[model samples]
Target: MRVHLFSLSFLAVCSTSVANLLGPVYPAPRDLSSKSSRVAAGWKALTGRLHSETSSGSSLLKNLTFSVGLFSIHDSAAESLQFHYTSSEIQNAPNGTRKVDGDSIYRVASLSKLFTVFAAMRELNSEQWERPLTEVIPAFAEYVKSRANADSVYSTPWDQITPSALAAQISGVARDVLPWDGGDLLLQYAIAILAGLNPVPAAVDPATYGLPPVDLNDALSLSPCLANVSEPCTGPLYAGGAANDAPVYLPWTSPAYSNNGFILLGLALANLTGKSLDEIYKQSIFDPLDMHSSYSAVPGASEFPRSVIAGDFTSGFGYDGGISKSSGGIYSTTNDLAKFGTAILNSTLLPPVTTRRWMKPVSHTADLQYSVGRPWEIYRYKHAESGVVTDLYTKLGDAGNYGSFLVLIPDFDAGFSIIGASALATRSNATSLLADLVTESILPALMEQAASEAKKNFVGKYTSDRLNTSLALDVSPSGNPGLSVTSWVSNGTDLMPLLGILLGNENSRLVPTIVSQGTGQVAFRAYTATQEKSGGLFQRNFDVNDWIVVGSGGYATKSLAEFVFEVDVQGKASRVELPACNVTLHR
Candidate 1:
């Protein structure tokens, strides 16, 4: 009913010739082949600064042993320019120490939550996901029935909670069920006690001392898997532990970080699939992605050589997390994690549509930059030049002596992993530092590389063999970004007019899509701008658009705006075929 005048103006402004319209489709991006080299150099400079800073032993990256991996589904060069830092402090014997690389193993802490949620998606149906925790885990259901007061803030509402809630960390449950998740702090306490710095009186029993107990009726914590010190919590153990625990927030009230939630989720998944969480992770993720260096729990002694082990917290590494393996107990190498991240970008495990649904945010957090997805901690990274916000679906983990980060950029079909360990037991600081440094360095490179590739591959004019039908495509870094279809003519009849567009010219963009129509083709759909007429009274976006919805939809069963590119050996565009027009155009 309405159109954006600027759409027509922008399209027409390209030039007097209709061919100008295509210039936006593949505007030549600045040549950044040397940018990656600069990035590599920048890392050296930054790491040199870090090395100088680390002599203090209190630097952010002090005594950090870490690995980083970057991956892109479409381009192999995205992995280049990675850095590894190994601190001599982490090893007792540095005489024969080997450098950490992509293959160095480290505990991945909460990043395991992503794998747990992924396994659930792979095996559970919608109905199963919606099924209440009581139905999913009979043990929890019985606990709910036994305590008529189970729905209060002092206890969890297991009957109303579902697998989805747990996966999203919205189940109103406590953050951790494992006493050992506190091993780092416990180690500190032990050191304090031995140092004669009495934070507590000598009369308090060591077992009864430290953090206050969380039990509801009695002053002591009720369960919290009190029965199992060495094994995964049994059904009754986990249920009783989570049931008596005080609620952090009301169900669906907000998203809180909860390893306990994922542990319960893992248990529910195990009950539903009739398999352990370990099996699910092994079968659904690690095996499919060929993540050979990843392990659900402590790696075998043979694999220990490849593991980055250090600090007093290292003993906790062998502690069996049991069902908690789904929460924060998995171990993986950057090399294998790169495979995992690239698999998600490539849609190698799930269908493209399903993968799309899985990567999205379920709810926003108090912080504008953060959102919660299916166990994903999403960060909104804003580009300085375009102000375009790139959603980074990420997971960060810190436990015992290890810390890690997994980041996926769906918009760019790229991602990276950071794994770090410290004798000082800084769970995530080192990895987080590495992640920030690498993110700053790599995001622009990815953006530039994508633009460069699009420029080389898709920019340029195309015409039918008859030369009567012509299409011009180009890209622009600002104003109109990405690939745009600037001009189009079919047999000397302007297609813009034939489409009934009274606007000056067609303002359309060729937006990239995750799915391809055929083998060896890159998929893209057309997007056009339109705006609904405003009566000059008050206004609402209900009718306004950048020009909303023009050239955006399909005609009949076929789309009126779709295009696929045939690429060359180096992935440069060879031809673009429009299925809607039933015509193929070549460069």
Candidate 2:
């Protein structure tokens, strides 16, 4: 049982156990003594906690089934890990399985939007992004007109809503067209009323609402409002009396998580492509990616399938035969998803340039507390104590009983996915907690691997005895793509007096470009002005073109002052000599 084996708090605790990346020590390999070993040990400790006998009983997370999937690309070496677990009793299980692996299928709610957006992008042009929803669905157009004379509260600018805005989740549509029950019944009436079209009702049980007709054209003929209901379309599905909760802003004015917008976008795709959402995905992506285990609708998936688990509180968890399907109807395994991720990252699915644009930030709030890409999410993970920041392109899915995460970090050339399900009502936060573990553990290790490879040549500590100063070279992949030298008091003893005489206060640190690889000319930008007294008069000193040059065992100062290095047989600098200043720095 993998119950609560990775708790949120425990993940936080395990974060500190990894080797300090900023220090001299390198990240350990995946072997027994490496960082991977620490992760495995952490997992083991948590597993023990999961199975520990408590006054209450066994842990809830240990009582449910779950799975984890990972793939790492560092220095071009690829590695993968996949495992799953289930409770001792089968009936209490969410997916009703004892174990799962990369190939095992599970419902990945909301992640379906990524596929839908991709499918739409392949066929739709830039202009289609802002194309009106009513233009694609004429019935929705009729609904707009019907509400023209009604209160201003229930209407939207039918002409301004676009698939792009909706995909970005900036469209002002309600979060859901209706609550679950209202949504289910609305799909029911939509099928009957849209007479000629085949509509997949929201109801999971076919007996609850028999399969409607298969005429897409006929269904397109239904009015937004039904004649049987004399009142204006209201409640969860329609325009009733104007209320305080009605959307006040138009599309793109703000950000809202609108499933209704996605559903409408799906309809627009069908309308524009003259293909069902199912056919669109099958033809555009699944086939191309070779995701055979993936399904829009699982076969004989009972009201609940062991393969397509739903939350304990969630009502429906099956194919998105209707509107919500485009928003949450995907069922896939980690292996299949990795293939999809590989396609996006490698630009096999779309052109490299276009895919890059797709991942760019599409929506962000003032405080940056909320932000998202076209269909993906942008996340920033900052180490609380060290301030090491990592950027991630990610997507999250939670279908009540099931929760999942798919992440990509281009910086590390690595990505991973986590999918798990639980029938235990107490395990609601399991998925997110596991996501934290992945974030706190896996990512930092991979980043360290990449950094170690990139910095093996020139990163070291250099000390100047005369100046009593120590300089630590940190090579970062950030702006300017170079190294930064930070000055520190040698041996933690304050040496401001020595530093003040040899180097200007402003010259304590240097950020310079790497003019050549293999320890070649490192140039530091030098300041020409000496100092400004209280009079605000700046005294000119060094030449305007002055710059520092670091070379083979020798360096030139801003004033063309030359310093030579004393090197060992390996050509590594052992000491740096500034003849003009009578200073020698030991490395």
- Which candidate wins on lDDT? 1
Write candidate 1's Cα lDDT for 1-587 as tens digits.
Answer: 00001111111211111111211223222222244443344455555665675566667776787777667675556465366777775556332134677777777877888888888989999999999888887777777788885448577777888999988878778876545345334434444555778564444324455655332334244354544435655766666656667789878999887877887888889999998778888999988888888999788878766677766433655656766778888888888888888887777878888888888888877765678889888776655454444677888887777777889977766677888877564545555666776667666655665666677678899999965888888875444456666678877877755443422226555656533434667766665433335344245343333333434455566676667788655567788887766789999
Candidate 2: stretches off by over 4 Å: 1-60, 73-79, 89-96, 146-151, 179-248, 300-321, 457-482, 485-587
Worst 10 residues of 2 by lDDT: 18-27
Once model 1 is optimally superposed onto the true structure by TM-score, how far is the C-alpha of residue 478 displaced, in angstroms?
Answer: 4.3
Q: After superposing candidate 1, which stretches have Cα over 4 Å from the reference?
A: 1-59, 76-81, 93-98, 148-151, 178-220, 227-233, 425-427, 484-487, 493-509, 514-517, 523-564, 568-570, 578-583
* Candidate 2 C-alpha lDDT tens digits along 290-372: 98877776534442343535343235444333545677777888888877776776677787679767877787754332357
Global fold similarity of model 2 (TM-score):
0.61
* Clashes per candidate, residues 3 or more apart or on different chains: 24, 17
User: How many Å off is the CA of 259 in candidate 1?
Assistant: 1.1
lDDT of each: 0.67, 0.54
Task: Say which candidate scores most in TM-score.
Answer: 1
